[model samples]
Structures are given as structure tokens and as C-alpha cells.
Target: MRLSQPRVHPLTNDLTPEQAEVLAPLGQGGVIPAGPVLNIFRTLAHAPQALKAFLTWGNYILSKKNDLPAREREIVILRTGFLCRSGYEWTQHVEIGLRCGLTPDEIQMLKAGPDAGWSPADAALVRATDELHADQFISNETWTQLLTHFSQKQAMDVVFTAGQYTQVSMILNTFGVQLDPGQTLDPDLRVG
Candidate 1:
């Protein structure tokens, strides 16, 4: 998608030719696709140890058998994506959220709030995310409801999942990250 804002850091133009080439393949287009944004991530990729650890943690969040269901995991992710206005995360995960069984309407409603026509379980998940992100704690009522649908272990897992995604959303948004060319924005998003 075309960028609507100037990149916060323009990496592609600033990189040494060799460093740019080394980091290009990890992004779309099989080369370090030229653009204003994405230079920040490309630069970070130069630190292979840090990059590998970060990607591994991201992989574990999605692949592990955490207490929350895949659907719940996706819900928190989508809500956090919209809240943070992370174009990259929102673009990529909206499709993943749908494939994981969130209806288009349900996903859109998350922009409004977690309680808009959501089931008790679903609303609780969204509330938990908001509380954690906003207040760094979930209230007892929401916690009790979350436990109704998730085991204790899953409850702990939810905190980590939301925390990880929140960090992702912040990094992506603050860096002015853009979706790679040919990627569409998530449907029905209402950004400020």
C-alpha cells in the first residue's frame, strides 16, 4: 500500500549497499524494497542475535499451546493492532484473524470496543487486553470471566501474548512502518 505519512526513519537510502542487500530478503519483494520506512527494521536486522531472538519469541506466541484459544489470541492481537495503529501488524493479522474464525463484523467491532455485541468470553479477552495495555492490570470481574473460558495457565499466557503484541504495535507504529507494496490494509479499520 502507498504510505500516507512520511517515514519516521528512512533506512533504505541511508544504508551501505552491502548492508541493505543483506537485510532485503527478509522483507517482501525479494530485495530490500526501496521505501522511506522499513529502513529502521532493516537496520535492526543487522544485529542477527537480537533479530533471531525477537522472531523466535514472536513465533512462540503464535505456535505455542497457550491457555487462550487461537481465536482469543487473534482477538487481542487485532484489538491491539487497531489501538496502536500499526499498519503492518494490522494488515498482516487481519487476514490471519479471519482465517482463525473472527467474522468481519466482529473484527470491525473491535475498533469500537470489546463489548460491542461480543460474547462474554470474547469481550473479556478484549477487556483484558485494554486493561493490561492501559492500566497494566485486569480487574477481578474481567479476570473471573476470562477464567471461565481459559485455564489458569492460559490466563498467564494471555498476559504475555498481549504484552508481546503491544510491544510490536508500539515499535511498528512509532517507527512509521508501512505495509509492503502489494499488501492491503485490514478491512474496515477506523484510524485517527
Candidate 2:
């Protein structure tokens, strides 16, 4: 966590009428779930329009409509969150990544990065994410390597997922969104 307390605390209840409407998708009868997503939603509800816009694109990225497979997309997401050192993002995505078929061992290996002996395709995904983080763009070499395994659309989704999570990571870190209950922060992600 970048800050000891939230710069904008999660709104737990007593949402205004407009806030309730904008946050309706998160729960039934205006009650959001208790978790990191809820914290994020409540904080973002401070700007309902922006939150609405965020959910629209975010849904597409996480949905089957995305060109990348769920597991592959999770790889990019976890890698990006790790690179960004966003504890909340990392903690939340670890659960989602597991559901998407990532092993605990593989999630740890992601912190080891592209050279961690992943298959060629998985390595390419990590390399692409690293390149985008370090250079804000993928290299031609990584791009070519990715094409060998991914459809062009999948390759594009790799970038899309990376960019989106990078943004999420930034928000979670900068906003001091603490870890959700029951989440253990990776020791590697702990800031001094």
C-alpha cells in the first residue's frame, strides 16, 4: 500500500440515489458485496460517470468477447499488477487467476518473469507485458514471437489487458486501496 489510509475511503452505505443507480450492477437491491471489488466500486462511485465508463470497457476485457483466453488474459493482468507493485490488484487477481486455471506455483513464477521457464507462448505473453511496462510498447521481436502462438486479435488483447491492468494497478496503488480481507500480500510486493 502506498499510503497508510485510503485517499478516498470506500462508501459502505447511505449512497445517494444517483450513486445507488450507478452502482446497481455490483449487487442486488443496492447492496454491494464485501471485497476488493466493492471497495474499488465505492471509491469510484465518487465519480459515477467515470466509474460507469470504466465498467463498460472493463467488462469487455474480462468477458469472453475478449480475444484472449481467460487464463492468458489473467497472465497479463497478474504480470502487470506485479510489475506495478499494486498489492490490491495483485491480491484480487491471484484469486481470479486461479479460477482461470493458474496454479499458485505459476503465479509465483510470474514474479520471476519471462525467463522463468514458461512455455514459448507464456513466455511471449510475459515478455510482451514487460516490454509494455518498461517501454510502453512491445518490441518487434516479442511481437513476432507472440504471433507464432497467438492470433493477431489475441496479441492485441495482450496489449489491451496489460494497459488496462496497468491503469488499475496505478489506481489501486495511488488511491491506497488496501488489501481485501483474507488476502495475503506477496512479500515481494511489500514496499519499504
Candidate 3:
């Protein structure tokens, strides 16, 4: 939401044959299909090696390797996306969040932040995200609360997930990555 329009347009003629070949594997699977590439992927394709490296880390975070459950991970991701006001991140994750078992109401509550009437466990998750966003470190109180519901690995995953999404939000915002075709921006995420 920081920029009115994309600073870097998606790849059209700029991609070399080698770059195109490198990005070809990304089209095979993941968030997008193998056809008309999404603007995000296309723009990222500009740096084929960096894009490939990013996908490796991204795959881990989105995969089972991160100790947080899918639903819990979505909670962190959605909250992080909201705090950063990254429309692209929020819109894409909204669907993924729902698929991971976050109710529409719970997704809405993420906009309100940690005190949006969530249960203790969920509230704790939001509180950790908020703390990390505001202070760049989770407070001891929030850490304790997180301990009640998550294992040490899961707790660490919370930090990693929040951190990863925070970085992603920055990329989406600063790069002005727009929502893909047929996708609408979340009302709260709209920039002036």
C-alpha cells in the first residue's frame, strides 16, 4: 500500500531465455499455476536466482517443516499482512487462511489485532505477532502465553513465520506488487 502503482512491472520482454528457463520450474506448482504468471512471480522473475532462493525458504515456511500448524501459521501470516497493510499479501493469504481453517470472522478479527475477542490461545498468537511488529521482540508475557499453547519448536516457528511474512509484506508493499487478475484488494488494505 505504500506506492500508488508498481515500481517494477512484471516481466514481459525483459526476460532472457536463460531467465525464462530458470523461472519455468516455478510455474509448475506452488501458489500459481503453469500458465499466465501472476504479477508477483513475473516481477520476481526479473531476478531468477534470487527468486529461486526465495522460493526455497518460502516452501519451507508454507510446508510442514515449520512447526506451527497450518491454522496457527495462517493466524500469524494474516496478522502480519494486516499490520504491514500489504494488500497483495493479505488478499492472497485470505484464501489460504480460510483453507487452513481460519473462519471468516477470525480473519476479520485479525484486522482488529490481538484484542479482537479471540480465545486465549489465538489471542496469544496475535499478541506475539503484535509485539514483534511493534517492538521487534516478543515480550516475556506474550512468550509465556505462547508457551501454554505451543511447543518450543512451534513457538520458534511463530517467530520465523511472523518474520518471514513481515519481510514478504515489505517486498509486496515497497515493490507495489498488485493483486493478480480477478483478485480484489481487502478494503482495509486499500492505500490512498
Candidate 4:
């Protein structure tokens, strides 16, 4: 939504030798198995080394080792994408968020922000994500609220997840990564 069209287009050809090697770890039998590679992967393939590094870190954020529940992680990611106004990121993650346990109504509520009647635990996460997006740091009060329900590690992962998606939203928005086939942007996220 940031750019009307792709500033950098996704790779449409077979991978170069290096692209295949660097991206192979992202494929089956590596750090994270790949299905059909998405446009984001193809676009990022322009910088294979960086994309490899990204996959490693991003895998940690999405993996079980992150300590935050999958649902909680999705909440932070959705909030980050929504706040960053990245329609591509929002649409991609909406399906993932649903699978991770957020309902349609709850996903809509994310756009309304932290005070949209979340449970105390969920609200703490929303507020922290909001602070991180707005201030690049969560306040002490929000940190305290987060600790009331989340372990110190979970709190860290909350920040980690939010931060990752903030960067991802930037990439998706800046690159004009359009929705994949059959995907539609949320009505509320429509930009003129």
C-alpha cells in the first residue's frame, strides 16, 4: 500500500546457483522448509545473504523457542502490520493469525488498538506493541503490565516478535509486495 506498484519486482526465473544455495536452507531439509516460495521471498532474493540471515532470525521468532504462545505472537505481528499500514503483511498474516487462534472479530479488534476490550494479558501485549511501534520502546508501566501475565522471556519475545514484523512491514510496504494470488486486502485497511 505504500507504493502503488512494485519498486522491486519478485524474481520470476529459476534461481541462480548462489540464489538457490542461499535460499536452499529456506527450502526443504534446511532451517525452515519452503512450500512454493512467496513473492516476498522472491523479492528478497535480490539479496540472498541478507535473506538467509533474515530467515534464521525470523525462524527463531516464529519457532517454539521464542517462548511466547503462537497466538500471542500472531497478535503482536498483526498489530505491527496493521500499525505500519502494510496491506500485504496484514493479508498474509491474517490467515496465519486465524490458524494461531485469533477470530475474525478479534483480528478486526486489533485495528481498534489496545483498549478494544482485550483481556488484561492480551491488552498488555497490545499496549506494548503499540508503544514499540510509536516509541520504538515499551514504557515501564506497560512493561509492568506485561510482566503480570507473561514471563520475562515471553516479554522479550513479545518485543522480538513486534520488532520483527515492524521491519517486515517496512519491507513489504516499501517493496510494494502485493498480495499473493487469491488474497484480498482487508476492507478497513484500504488506502486511497
Q: Can you write out model 1's per-residue Cα lDDT over 96-128, one digit (the tens) per residue?
A: 888779898887888888769898888888888
lDDT of 2 by residue, 1-192 (tens): 666689988877778888888887674421223334467778889888888899888888888889999899999999999999988888878888998899999999999999998999999999999999999999999999999999999999998899999999888888888776667887888887
Using lDDT as the measure, the top candidate is 4
Clashes of 4: 0
lDDT of each: 0.72, 0.87, 0.87, 0.87
Score residue 36 of candidate 1 by CA lDDT: 35
- Superposed on all Cα atoms, the candidates' RMSDs to the truth, in angstroms, are 5.0, 2.7, 1.6, 2.2
Preferred candidate (lDDT higher): 3 or 4 = 4
Q: Tens digits of per-residue lDDT for model 4 on 108-164?
A: 999999999999999999999999999999999999999999999999999899989
lDDT value, candidate 1, whole model: 0.72
Q: How high is each candidate's TM-score?
A: 0.76, 0.93, 0.93, 0.93
Span of 10 residues, lowest total lDDT, candidate 3: 26-35
Total backbone collisions for each predicted model:
3, 0, 0, 0
**Which residue pairs clash in candidate 2?**
none
Off by over 4 Å in 2: 27-37
